[model samples]
Structure formats: structure tokens, C-alpha cells
Target chain A: MARWLLISVIYIELIIVSLGTSSVAQGGQELDWAALDWKALDWEALDGWELEGEAFAQARYFPDNPLYIGQHSQNQSLALELSAYRKFSDSFSLEFIPFYRHDFQDDERSHLDIRKAYALWASPTLEIGAGINKVFWGVTEAVHLVDIINQTDAIEAPDQEEKLGQAMVSLSLPLPSGLFDLYLMPNFRERNFPGEDGRLRGALVVDTNNPLYEHKDKDHHIDWAARLKQSLKDGELALSYFEGTARDPNLIMPLGTPSPVLLPYYSQIKQLGLEGQYIKDEWLWKLEAIYRKGQPNLQFEVEDYYAMTGGFEYNIYSIFESSQDLGIILEGIYDQRRDNALTFNEEDIVLGTRWSLNNMHSTEVLGLWIQDADSSAHNFVLELSTEIGNSIAVTVEALIFSEQQRNSDSGRFTADSIGHQMRQDDYLQIEIGYFF
Target chain B: MRNNLSNPPFHFLASILLMIPLLVQAETAEQKGRAIFEEIDRRDLNFGDFSSDQEMILRNKSGQESRRIMENTVLEGGNKDINDGDKTLIIFREPKRIRGTALITHAHQQRDDDQWLYLPALGRVKRISGASKAGSFVGSEFSYEDLAPQEVDDYTYEYIGDEIFAEQDCFKVKRVPVDKDSGYTQQFVWVDKSEYRIQKVEFYDRKATLIKILTITSYQQYLDQYWRPGYLSMINQQDGKSTDMIATNYVFRQGLTEADFSENSLRRAR
Candidate 1:
């Protein structure tokens, strides 16, 4: 299949080259002018379409013993992301992106997703789009607390940057004061989690096949969202609201069941989120806050809560008189429910520093440490990426857990103590990608 | 001495000597250099808005080559008091991985420019500090400062002399950057005396060493008043690398407004 694709690409390039040369050649005769017109039309047709993609191979190594049986300390995978875009006219365009990954260790890790398949019509004042799409809405770098349009593709990575496309119809209005966007999402997609054989799985395997929803419509329940963003002279403010099923599921372990597995429960939720970013020369202040209601807790009771992630990024450029930039990020995470919050970052601090080498290769390095305020637990992450050439890129990542001390008062394990559960899952990953 | 001064020829010489200081004070080197720059700026004004397609070919010492293609749009802003800088948006279409990526820049005359980068894959826009103007532009040999709009207030100028370059008489001028964060301390520019258009520039690093040379060629006239370069070549003397840039498909007076250059426009750059 790869060879066939290469040959087809070469064939198209040759035709384009020949057409270009012929168009530039003499065209004074009537017949030659007619041929030139046809060639120009063909050229326009070719110019309206574009195809691009990247193929990557990834490997991960864990130094510690696996907590679950059937899990390995080493894993490998291959993935491809291809996108094709076509401009029908100046006002309309279509984009289709298909992604696939194959894992050698776990069956559930191998998956396919359509990242984007959308048709859009845009004018000076309004834009209308339909089909499967991905939308992100947030400002804080530590975590995307306000973004809810797409479901998390958790199996892909731990950072939650990867998302599964959501089927929706969206509208955008650009006004004098700000930009307003409205979305009507019809189909609800479930999040992807690691299988039992995967290293990142919890103590009990999650039975994704049997998910329970609070609404009778289940996966067919319609979701709606809207947002208004305004850019000021030195800052930006955005207000967003979403009404739909919560992306974060509540895991329920059935009692007295023959198969010990956790069932994911999706609850309906209404959330109001606010995002702000203020830029003052070398310093950038960011904030993302969300007020959510009608989400159940571990006790299966509905609860209302608010969460916020606020921080500032200080950029220092040309350190040591070299073409390098250093940025320090300090964000504070807060949850109103405190211990009752479903996330591990109830009250935590994230301190990170990013070093960028403004060179020909575009090398960058990021280091982050997330420290829990109540406990001594901490999560350390490091990432480095660099380009080998115009088409090849390499990335390295490491995740480590340290000082995870379990509560001595309650000897039993609880769902809120995810940091303790992930203590032994430290791993190092490397990825090599070829782009075209 | 008194008798010589009383003579007619000596009196003429004395008057000329007296007038020499006045003439020097009337038009100093700095003032003449600044006037030339102002002329160039004035001729390029009133082009309300424009969009163009640009291509860059980067070559290493070993002769390996790579190509980058992008689309650029500019909205004239400095003419009015409310807007003191030009707004520019650039969208990349080549080097597949960076396709759909966009950059927006608000170039200012007396202060650091405001810039933002939009990554299409991540659906995120990141603000870049203006202090990084010396950074390489998309891994190319050209730096951000090299491409940014040049304002007369950003530098102090001195008229050097006149020289014949490329068979055309040109005026040589030296300019020192006013911003301390600038990578280059001074630069020498050559402008054609006839059209008042820049023809070549020599950049000197902070250590006062010549580092890079840029030459503009293939001049094209637009609207019967403005001259635009169709091709540019930048060579790095210290690195032995070079880049060739070609611009085409120019559209002038497209009726673009300030709204079109907003941050929301970055998302719709494609």
C-alpha cells in the first residue's frame, strides 16, 4: 500500500511538472492557446486539493514490575494520521482526517478514529460548519478544564491533548465586540481507556462494553454548547456553556458479580466555563474556571461543584545571549469539593518550565512537576522534541511518580487516590515520525 | 592677515568659510538619511490592503534544498492615529506538518511588536514575546526582525556616501538599532537614488562583525507608484548558508478591514 501511494504521488508530480512547462512554452497559435486554457483549468483543479499526513513508530519502557498480570514492561506501537482538504470555492471547504494506531501489547490499545471530517462555509461575518469536528476551548496550560466539545482519547496519551471528533453542527458570528459560536452536537462518543492488559489500567478492569447513562437516550442524547470570546488590547476573555453528558465517567464496581469489573456511568451535566488571558510584555496570565452541576459523586448522588486553574507564564528570551527562550509556568488547581472531587488534582500546584532552542531544528524541552497540597505525592513529567530534517521528527517523554504516601487512617483503597494507584506506572516513551 | 581679509578674493573665501558651518547645520548626515527613509515610506503608503503568495527555498552548505510555501495578507494601519502599526497574517501551506499553522503580527514603530502563533493541529493560539525577534523564522535563515515592517523611529541613521551598484547609482546609509534587544547593532543599507528603493543591506552583529547580506531583485511597479521586489536572496557570512525567497500573485487594495486582521482571523487563515 505504501509503495502504491508513493508511485501515485510521483505520477501526479510528473503531470503537474509537464503541465507547468507546457503552459510556459509558446502559445501564439489558436490551437496552442486552447491547449493552454485546458492546462490552466487542470492546474486550478489540482491547486484546490491538498493531501498530507504523518506516520510514526513509538516505544515505551517501564522499569518497575507491572501491578497487573498479563501486562508487560515494554510496549511498541505504530500510528498514522492523514488529512485531505479540498477547497470547493472561496467560501466553502471540506476537510477529512483519518487516524489509526496499532499496539503490540493490548487489543483495546489498537484503535481507529476520525479526527476531523467537516464541511465549512465561511463569509466575512458568519461561518457555518457541519459533520464530525474537534473544538478546544481553554487557556490554562496545566489542564484544559473548560474544553468539552470532544471526548478524550485517553489510550493515546496521558496529557489529554488527543481527542475523538464529535459530530456537530456549528455556527460562528464575528461581531464588532467579540466572536460568538454556537454548537449542536447530536451524537455522544465514549472515551477510550486502557484495557486490562495495558500498563496504565487501574486495579480493576473497566468494562467499556456495558456503560450506563443517566439519560434514556444514552449515546444518542443531544448536546449543546455556546461560547463568546472577546480580544482586548492586551488580553482576551471567553465565556462558554455546555449542557450534555459529562466526559468524565463515574466508575461503579458491581457487588457480588462473577466478573470483577468496573462499569462507567455517564451523568448529565450543565457547566459554565470562563477563560481569560492577559498579556503584559514578557508575562502572560491565564485562567480557566468551570461551574458544573448535576454530576454524581462516588456515592451515586448528584453534586454541584466549581473548579479553577489559574497561572502565569513568564518568558525570558535570549538567555546567555543565545537563540534560546525559557518560559516558567506556575498554575494552581482548586476544586470546591476538595476530597470529594473525582479528579486527583483537587488542590494541587503545577510548576513547569519550557526551554525552546530557536534554531534550524526547532528543538524544545518541557519539564513539569504536579504537587498535591494535602499529600506529599508528586508527578514529574519531561518531554523533548526535535526535528531531524524537513520530514522527520523525534520526541522523547518520561513520566515519574514520587513521594506517594497513602492515607494511614483508611487502609482501604479509594477511587480518589489515583496518584497512589499510579505510583508504579512510571515509564519512558520515544516516538519517531515521518511527515509528508 | 587683516590686509588679506580686506582683499576681494580673501573676502569671498572668508564668506564661504562662514557659510560652510551654516550649510553643515542645515542638512546633517542624520537628517539626510532620515529624509531618504521617509521618502521610501511615503511612496509605499495608501496601498490600503494586499495579499500575496510567497515561497522560500533554503539551501545548506552541502547544497541540500527544502521549500516552504505560505500566504500572507497585510492591512495598512500606520496612516491613522488610532492604529500605529501594520497588521499582518501569514498561513503556512507547505511542509505538511506545519500546514494550516498561522501567525499574526502587529508591528509597532516605537515598541516591541505583538505576535501570536496558531497551531492548527492543537487548535491553540500561543502568544510569542516580542523579545524573540532575533529568532529564526520557521527554521529559515531569515530572522523575525528581518521580515518585520521597518519603521523610521526604530533606528538612528547616518548618510555614508554614494556608490554605483549593479550599474545603478545608489546611496549608502548606516543605521543603528534603537532597541537594545536587537541581535544586530548596526546595518548598512543601499537605496537606488532614482526610485528611492532599497537594493541591498549588510547586517552587523552585536559584536560589530558583518554577519549577513541581503539583496533585493526583480523590481515590479504597482499602481504606477509603488515598487515591489519579486525576489530576495539572504546569505549568512558566518554560517555559509543562504535562502532564496520569491513572492508572486500580488493583489492590492483588497478592501480588507481591521476586523479581518483580528485574532479570530488567524483561525480562518486557511
Candidate 2:
């Protein structure tokens, strides 16, 4: 608790310094900010034009948990991200970002290190990009929290993968009734294992803001996507489909006899998913379902998995009169996995509330209840974050578990199997960051 | 019931007689206003030589303002090929910080319009696109289409009625858009009856909202034949911003030939 308090004080001090200096500079006459001139030029005047470049900086900090019990200690880290962007034309631009980090903890194991980059080109009808970029899927605010997954470990859950290399292209074509967009992507890089070869993916994305049915008007819209996915949103979903040769198959087996080696080939592993969403004014509701076929080989047999998720999010306005926009989200997910080695079924109900306090401050609190056919568990998470200015943001998060499942005990045929035993673990993390 | 209704016939006749004069006055006023509006719409004002000083102010939603001063010179002619080519030069004087930037717009009715913008920072001139004559100059309330010299044949006008604006008796006229994709659905203008100059205009957006209001003030006649407004102010109701153009100097009857409005001439004008 003492250490957490110390980190919080330091974080607040740094923010005050940065914001005070920025405000002073802006108030002075040294910098000239010009308003846009609307009538000086003709139509198509901005087409094929480029603007001069400017430089900026950003910094952030995450503090330790203030409330917890038993061996409570906080982990804190700070990172700086620098970026530059240049527009070659109205349709094309290039961007570069570089980042560095430092952790306050004495142990080197708790430190963070990463390098990430991406580029994008956009036109009226086409968009293309390559590098380690983040893509979001699903439309529901609560159920799609899984889609908001970030690659950087310093900013996201420690267990999550931060970056992956991929190339993608998307094109939008206007149709008589509406518009149609097609997207294709191929991911060739992995974070923790040898890069997989001979694996490619594609998706068809259709977005329409126009009315689909005669009874509906332009305000009622829909977005749909069909994707060929080799990886799931969460790593837990990858436990299924064990066929297809791994780049390092030996990494999975016990270190004794020769690990089974399979020829490089394409194995059939497929999943079909559909999501429908309806948004009207302040009300939003969504339903989603996915089913995947398991792949099996001689050494290990994987499982088939299916899951359905439904949720609604409502923005509450009359609650806080000033500086805060609050919203409540409710979601439920049911998942089932069946295989020769094991069969597991689970259902999760999550309730969360998010508060956006002006442009500079925001916080979210979530409670998760998991009911397994074999056991039950509860998890609670709270995150508070704020953007100090244009360049700086800070976040602190805490996660607590009532009954946890460990990887070593989650499988079949063991005394410590997840079905027969239970354990609990709590994690607290703090991060401070700067960007330029 | 039939006997009672027949007893009130004399009272009904008295009410009808009372309304006749009111209706006649309304019809006569509309007729007089329409005639004046049609006369102004039919004549195309020819420009000989003109110069004016303008003050421009750019503001944001937060009510912050930036001001600029500019000078303009134009040599205009009619459709009879009297001055087939002529040039208009606009120069910025103050704030002295942006004094060296200039814009030269040349008009050639036979071909396309050409313009050049000269920047002091780059010390070079660049050609501007003519295809954008129908588009907004800068995300502003006035589009490039509004900046073009009003051609007599470009629009068909209808006189609506008489109205009082800023204590001036004005003729109200409605202009239907000829271009299909014009940002405005229709424009309503109130022209001063005596001066034959536009006193006020209400621009209706595609959504049928009163998006922009333009008012003309301080008029000065040039060369005794051309009545020019010294100040024109446009207020964007939605964005809370206004642009005010104020003319300071005037010169008439400058000899400018048609050859000056060509693209080849734009490169040489600077």
C-alpha cells in the first residue's frame, strides 16, 4: 500500500508539470493557431494537396490499487510513444511510430519492452494497410469488449499478445441499392511461437447505412462480415483444432521421445459466425453466435466449440449533470467444447458500467460471473484512466478472482484438474506513459 | 330552421363588402413588388473598372476571431466580346504579417476560368482547379458557386412580394437552382427598391433550414452608373461564424483587354 501511494503521488506530479507547461505555452502568443478559411478556394481545392508537418509529445501513468487484502503490491511502468505522419496526396499518406518504456519495479522480470509500427493508405473507394495494426470486430459495447483487445502488453492485459504482422486490403463499391465493401487479410506472424507458413485468411465485409427493408428508414442500418479466421479473439478458443503441422511441433510434447512430426499441409479447420445489431437513438442491442469444427490428428485430438453472445448497452444522461457521460452494459455468453480428451461447458454473465468524465477523465468497472458445468468462479475488474492533454494519458487497473483456473490443472486425468480443484489469484498493475 | 337562416342574409352581405378593400390592397402591393424585381433580374450589370478594400474575419465555434485586410481590382465586360479577356487581382495588405500573398483570377467567357495563387513563403505561383467552381471554397457558408459573377442567363427568377428590411422598401425574389447538385435548394433575396442592389438574402440548405443570412450595407455608386455595396456580411447560423467584406477604394473605366483572362496570361500576370 505504501508503494502504491508513492507511485500515485509521482504520477500526479508529472501530469501537473506537463499540463501546466502546455497551457502556459498555448496561452502565450508564440504559437499561431489559424482558423480554417472556407470560401477562399473553389471545389476540389483540397484534392491532391498536402500540409506541413508538426511535432508533439504524449505521456501517461497508471497507479496501484488502493483497496485490496493480503500481500497486496503494485506493479507500475511508464512508456513513451513518438509518431509522425505525412500526407503525399489526398488519397495516400505515410505514418511512423516508435515507442520506449521503463518500469519502476526492481525485478527485471516485471519490465516491459516492445516495438510496433503500421501504415495506412485510404481513398474514396479503397483502403490498404500492412504492419502490426489492431482491428476491432463485433458491434456490441459489452460483448465486443473482446474485440477491443490491444497488442501492447504494457497497456493491455499482461497475458494478451501485443503485436502481430499482417497485410490487409479493403475496397468499397457503390451499388444501386447501397454500398458493398470487401476485405481480405493474411496474417503470417506469431508472437510466442515460430511463424506459421502456408496459412492465409480472407473476409467479406458489408456495411450499409441505408434502409434494408421497405419498412425501415435510412436511420436503421446494419454491418455484416464473414471472416476465415485461424485464430480466435481469445487464446482460450485456440485449444480446439489440433491438426495442421505446427512450425515447432515439439514445443507442445513432453521432452522425451521423438516428437511426432506431420508433413506441411492444409488441414480443414473452419468456423462460421453471424452477428446482428440494431441501434436507435440511445438504445443498442446485439446478438452473435459462432461455431467451429475441430481438427484431429493421431497424437492429439482437439475439440469442437460453439458460443453465443447477446448484450445491450444504454447511455445514461440524467445521472451526472456535468463532465460525465455514464453508460451501463449487460452481456451473457454461453460456450461449449467437446473432444475426445475432455468436454467442458461454461456460461458467463458480465455487468459493467463506464463513465466518461469529460474528454480528460474516464473509468470503467466490471463484474463477471462464470458458471461451469463442473465449477463456478467470480471475477471483478476496475479501471480508471485519463487523458491529461492531447499527448498524455494514464490508466490503472485491478483484477480480483474468487476462484481461478490454472493451466496446469485445467486438463483431463489429473488430481489437480480444474473440475476437481479450485484456486484464486489477484493481480494489480499500474502503467505510466508518454507519447510524441 | 329555413326561416331563421333567411333572416341573416343582409348581415352576411355587409361582411363580404368589408373584406373587398383589404384583398385589393394586398394584390396591388404584390403586383408592384414583382414588377420591380423582374426589372432588376433582367438587366446584367456590366463592369468597367472597379477597386475595393475588404476586411475578412474567420471565427470558430468557440467565438475566437482572426481578422485580415485585403484590396481587390477588377476589369469586367459584357457577353458581347467587348473585353474578351480581363484580369482581377486581389492583394493582402494587413495584418502586415501576411502582406505578400496575392490571388489573380482571370475570366474568359469563351473558354474556362483560370486562377493563380501566389504565396510569399514559397515565392512561387500555383494554378488552381477550375472544376471546383461549383464546390465550397473552404468548408464555408458560401460556396465557390456563390463567388462567380451573377450571369443573367444562369437563373430564372420569380418575384414574390414586397417586404421591409433594415427600414428599406425591398422587393422579395426567389431564385430556383439550375445546377442539380448545388448545395442550396433555393435562395430568397430582398433587393432595395430604389438602388436596385441586393439588401439581404436568405439561403436555404438542402435540409430546408435557414443556414445562412447575407446582408449588404454601406453602398456607394461607382462612376455614377454602378451602385456597389461597400460592405457585405455573411452569417452562418449553424456554425456561429461570419465573413464581412468591406470595400475601400474604387477605380472606373480602366482599359483591360480580353487576352488578359486566358490561362497563358495567368502565368504572365504574376
Candidate 3:
């Protein structure tokens, strides 16, 4: 009799709970962070087209350009990225992304290009793809030193996050404990650099159209890359090798240019990169190292060198009872060919932080400070991104440069050095993107 | 009934005699609760593998809501090793930007669970460290720990008592997580003895306060022997947030093998 009575009471309570839930479900509150209905939207607007605008201002100027060339930069730009995608079945798909940008300050920065045009076929354990595509490798937060698959899209961004897609046929096969990918790239694309009129350009501007190549086949030479990656329970590792014309061009002075103009020259190169990361509790240890042959030295010789970037990241969650996370990232980079390497971050330390507010807006902020070991230069960058609504995104970035240590840089960028060239180009950028 | 009892209960005497073995087998509340849990696990061990499409709806205070659709495939434990837990893959399909994100988890009883996240943007597999089980799943109320395959040895149980809940006879049990880094200190669960299926659970946070309450309903039996809940909803008592997970479809025995759950398959899971 007691059991039956309790059952009746429990049933009553459950009905009350159900009623309460139903009322709330039908109440006045609105949806937050809801997945915007992608299926209901027009396919052409949702997947085919995107529009973006950017505003930029230089905070400081290098002494040489404004006085001699009278170049002062305050610029606005518009960009459009068009993508076409189709899926025939679970086994086949196609994608194409073409972007066009127009900059008011530099006409060279305004152009149309295709980033990717790829077709893919996949089985359960194997996949094959062909056409122009972008592939990224490495696992470091501060600097992606080992991600060398694609040439940089110089005018697109200063952070080196954007790339010009490569044309290749690739295959990925599953290993018992890892994944192996093989790529046969038949087209080589030279890197593009900012023009003289651009604020972020080097002191002597780069000639984008004209370039020399060590290989007689030049841009036609086929390049190849292979990677084997394994994912463990709490760690990951990858070994990748690339043989092709160097993506980073060596600057050579042309006969016509009196000012030390940089003519891009590609050289033969072979690189082997190893990347791995392991996580322990709240701390993550990341490492990326590469050994390369055929990087042009100071004497324009194919010299061999090694470089590495290692770091750790630690984060604190639910800060101050709010669903936010603050993460601290630290990494140190060292290069065996201190001044002969392609990048300016030789023997440097990077300190950065990431802030993520777990909110409906999906807001995030990242700031990084990279300082040279000799205390000659400092590079500081800050980026903040958030969604404006369901279909738009807004981002703001600031790049600041400190005093350059004259003649301290050991890299191939010795003439202008990355520090001095960027010192006067310190600028703030604001960009907004509409997805549909 | 009175006449029957007047005979000193021939049926009652036999019932008491029948209870002797049970009394011997379960001396304490903890043992009895553990035995029931282990029995349920054993009965559930027969299922080999299954897949389903699911939608997870999250709501904050003031009734604001957000929804995400995903597909999940789970391989039953003991199909390979008796001590091994289930292998599961969750593929996010909706919220367009995060589409094609796949998380594969291989749960083990002896050590930490292995997890891999295949990022569509990066086109690479990322290891979500074992220690990250305490973190939330895609910013939802459910943590990786909450969704992990339940192994009998992962928690210790204490029988709270028998009670009628949801119009059915139920066993109330308190379960304390044995994993040192568990976000919850203890959880109180309601299980219906008739089907040996979970009906409700109340989660206590690290501070041992009631943090979340989960209620399951719309149970449908598959293959005549497997009872699968159609919907599971969790409400955060402290934050007024909630998550409702509803399974839309299910397919059993697709001939999934251990290789299918491997990290290499994650990138191809779509």
C-alpha cells in the first residue's frame, strides 16, 4: 500500500516537472548561439559568395619612405571570395575557392586569384584528390615553422596565415597505427610580396612578376611531398619531407633598379620536418623542427641548416566563476644558420596569451610578443575576432615593431632585415566579413 | 490473503528461503548496488555496435536555446577485451562552420580514455588529452566525462534505498567517481529494476553540490533486447542551463571494426 502511494506521488511530481519544462520550452526566451539554418538559405548565397572589407592605418613611418618617396598610408580595401562546392556521393566531392581583393593604397595588392580547385574521392581507408589545394602542417601555436607546403599570399596578410594554393595529385592511405599521405605536385608557384606602395612592404619593394629560378624548368618543375602522421592517446607526431624549389625566395638586385630592389629568386631545396605535441594535465608541450638543404646562404650558395621551435601552453578555466579561459603560450625558436635562414625569428623568444570567452558571440583574443635574443628587435601582434551575428565576422589586428638592431639579423633578409622594413610599417587593421 | 498468512505463510516461508542466497550474496548496500550495476553491464555486453543521428539542444537561463546536430557510432565493450569499454565516434554535421568535426574516443578501464579530434579546417587529427575529460564537450553542459563509456570499475556505488519514481519501482544509488580528476564528486542515479535501465541522475560538482539533473525518457527497445532511450535531457541546477539530446535514427551492426575507430579513420569518418 505504501509503495503504491509513493508511486502515485512520484507520478504527480513527474507530471509537474514535465509541465514546467513544456511551459519553459514554449516561453518568450529567444535562441542564443543557434546554428544558423544553412539548409534553408540559398545555396548560391550560403556557399558561393563572401564579401569582406578592411581598413588600415600606419601608426609610425620609416624615416626613408615619407621624405624621399612621400608615401604615407591610410588605406581601405574590399575583397570577395567565391567558392563552389558539390558532392556527388559519399565517395566523391569537388571544391573551388577564388578570391579577389582591391586595395586603395597599392594596386599590386589588388588582384584575383584562385586558392583552391580540388576534386576528391574517398574510400573507408583511402582517399585521393587532385587539383589546386592547400595543405598545412606542424603544431606550434607561436610560429608554424614547419608548415611549408604552400607559398605565402604576401599581400593578403602580414601574419603569414594565408597561402596560395598548389596544384597536385595526392593520396592518403591509412596505416595500422598512422596515416600516410603522398603528394605529387606538378606546378610550382612563386611567393608574392607586397609592392613598394604598400605600407607593409620591405624598404626596397619586391618585384612580384619577375623572378629567377635555379631549376631550368622553373615554375614547371614538379615538386613532391610526403607525410606520415600518428595520433596516440594524448600525443601526436608527424614526419614530413618535401623536395622542390624553395618557397621562400632569395632576393637579388636587378640591373635596372638603383635602390636595392628585391627580385625574387627561387632555389632548389629539400626539407624534412618533424612535429609533435604532448599534453599533460593543463599543460601542452609542442615541438616543431626542420632540417633543410638548399636554402640560399649569404653567398647565394645552397646551404644546409636546421631550425626548431618548442613551447608549452597552460590554461586556467572558468576564471572568476565565468565560462572564460585564459591561456599562456611561450615558445623559443633557434636556427642553426642564424642569419642565413629565411625568417627573421632566429634565436628568438615568443610570449603570448589567448583569451576565450565562452559566450554566444564566440569572442576570442590573441596577443604575441616576439623578441630577438640580442635585444635588437621586438615584434608584437594582437588579434581579436568575434561574430557579429549569424553570418558575419569581425576582426581587429595590430602589428607593432620596436627598434631594429642594425646588421644583427643573420637571415637572407640581411639588406633590409625584417625588423627595419617592418618598423615603419607598424599598423592597425580592421576587417569585417559577411559569410552569405 | 489472510487465510494464506494464517498457515504461517507457505509462500512467505519459501520467499524468505529464496532471499537467503541474496542476503548472503549482498551483505551491504554497496555490494548490492554494485552487483546490480555489474549485472546491467553484463546484460548490455551483448550489443556489438550501433550508430545514430542526434541533435543536442542547449538552453540558457530565460529559455534561450541553441542546437547542434551530430552523428554518433558506438561499439560495445567486451567485443574484443572484457575490460575494454566502448569506442565511440561523434561527427558534427550542423552549425555549418563546425561541420565535419569528428571526435573519436576509445575508452579503457585500466587507464585513461584515448580521444582524437579531426579538425576540418586544419585537416589534421588532434589529440584531446586524456586529462581533458574534465572539460566540457563543445561548450555544452555535458563534459567528456559525462559521455564516456561507463565501466563497472570506474565508480563505486552505494544503495540509497528503493523508491517509486516516474510511476515505476526504482533503485536509488549513489555513485562516487573513482577517477581522481573527475569534475563530479558523486552522482545519484535512479534505475528501474524492470528493465535495468537508467531513468534519472543528479550530478554533484566538485564541491559536492547539486549541479545538474538528467532525466531520460521515450525508451524504445531495439532488436527486442536492447532498450535505447530516445531522449536524454540535462538541466544545470546552479546555472539554469540545460541540454536536450534526442536520437533521431539508429542502425545496428554495420560491421564496424576496431580499425574503423582508429585515428586514421577519423579524418575519413564523414
* Best-fitting candidate, scored by TM-score: 1
Q: What tens digits encode model 1's per-residue C-alpha lDDT throughout A270-333?
A: 9999999888777889999999999986557788989999999988765765557788999999
Which candidate ranks first by DockQ, i.e. highest? 1
Candidate that beats the other on lDDT, 1 or 3, i.e. the better one: 1
In the range B40-90, model 2's lDDT, one tens digit per residue, is 645425666666777665554676555556777776655465444446776
Give fnat (model 1).
0.32
How do the residues A199-294 of candidate 2 rate in per-residue lDDT, one tens digit apiece?
A: 000011111111122112211112122332221111001011111111111112223435332222112335555555544334456666756554
Ranking by DockQ: 1, 3, 2
lDDT per residue (tens digit) for residues B88-153 in model 1: 999987665677899989887766777878888777777766666776676567888888877788
Clashing pairs in 1: none
* CAPRI tier of model 2: incorrect
How well is each residue in A43-87 modelled by candidate 3, as lDDT tens digits?
323332222222222222233334225356566778876655655
Model 2's interface RMSD: 17.5
Per-structure clash totals for the candidates: 0, 17, 2
| Model 2 segments more than 4 A misplaced | A1-74, A99-122, A128-132, A142-155, A158-165, A169-187, A192-268, A295-300, A320-323, A338-346, A359-376, A405-425, B1-8, B14-270
